[model samples]
Target: MKTEEHKMKKERWEKDMMLEHRRIEMEEQRLQWEQEQEIMFCDVTTMDDDQRAYVLAKRAKIAKAMSASVGETASGESGV
Candidate 1:
C-alpha cells in the first residue's frame, strides 16, 4: 500500500540521517585527536639534549598524573 511504502521510506531516511550524523561526529573527534597529537608531539627533534630531556620528563609526569586520575575515577574515588 502507499501508506506502508511511505512509512518505509521515512524509516530509511531517518536511518540515513542517523548514519550521517554519526559520521560527522566521528570526523570531528578524529580532528580533535589529531590536534591533540600535534600539540603533544611538536618538533622535538629540533631541541637540544637538555631541552629534550626536560620535555620528556614533563610528558612523563603528565602521563603519570593522568593515569592516576583515571585509576581513581575508575575505582569511584575520584576525590572531585
Candidate 2:
C-alpha cells in the first residue's frame, strides 16, 4: 500500500545501492592484484645495501610509478 512518491524513493535508493555495490567490488579486485604483486617481488629490507642499490637502480621506473620520492635516506639504504 505504498504511495507513488514513496515508490519512487524506494527505486532511487535501490539504484544507489546497486551502484555502490559495483564500486566496492571493483576496489576489492584491485587490492587483490596489489597483494599478489607484492608477494611476487623480493623483500628488499632483508638485502644488503649494495644488493638493494642494484635492485633499486634496475627497478627505478617501477618505484617512480609507485610514487616513491628518492632522496638521501634512500641513498643510504640502497648503497651497493
lDDT of each: 0.81, 0.72
Candidate 2: where is the Cα deviation over 4 Å? 43-80
lDDT of 1 by residue, 1-80 (tens): 99999999999999999999999999997996675566468778999998888777767775776689799999999643
lDDT of 2 by residue, 4-71 (tens): 88999999999999999999988997996676466448688998999888767656655654444355
Worst 10 residues of 2 by lDDT: 71-80
Off by over 4 Å in 1: 44-80
Ten-residue stretch with the least lDDT total in model 1 = 32-41
Error of 2 at 27 (Å): 0.9
The total number of steric clashes, by the backbone 3 Å criterion, in model 1 comes to: 0
The numbered model that scores best in TM-score is 1
TM-score, predicted candidate 2 vs. hidden true structure: 0.48
